[model samples]
Target: MGRPLIHRSPMPGLGLSMGITLTMLSLVVLLPIGALLLKGANYGLAGMWDTVNRPRVWAALYLSFRLSLFAALFN
Candidate 1:
């Protein structure tokens, strides 16, 4: 048997609200991630690996991580 209907919400415009929420979420979250993925694809796996493996990249990453850790500890 089908489930009994529950009480309906008194609120209106749920469809419009959901559309706006999805649009905002896609623009704010998905677009940048998609761009990053496209960039990585263009760079290719070996190129990305080489870039990350560079000494300067490693140093900068290490410094950033250390600074973030220090800030977190301070806070």
Candidate 2:
């Protein structure tokens, strides 16, 4: 016979730890990405492109890039 699918773990509270880890992973990493994907889907590609193409967005991007480069060079 093959090994059982579920076996007892040597470490106590392993299931609880796993549950907490998965919950934190879902909340911290997955939810915001899912929301962004949903919003992007609602907007469609052209709308997303138009939003990104604005002068303000470009200016902010350029400023952030220059600041990041400056900090990186010093660091």
Tens-digit per-residue lDDT, 1-75, candidate 1 = 999999887888888999999999999999999998889888899988988899999999999999999999999
- Candidate 2 global lDDT: 0.95
TM-score of 2: 0.54
User: Which stretches of candidate 2 lie above 4 Å from their native place?
Assistant: 1-34
Residue pairs with backbone overlap in model 2: none
Off by over 4 Å in 1: 1-33
Q: What is the TM-score of each candidate against the true structure?
A: 0.54, 0.54
By lDDT, the best candidate is 2
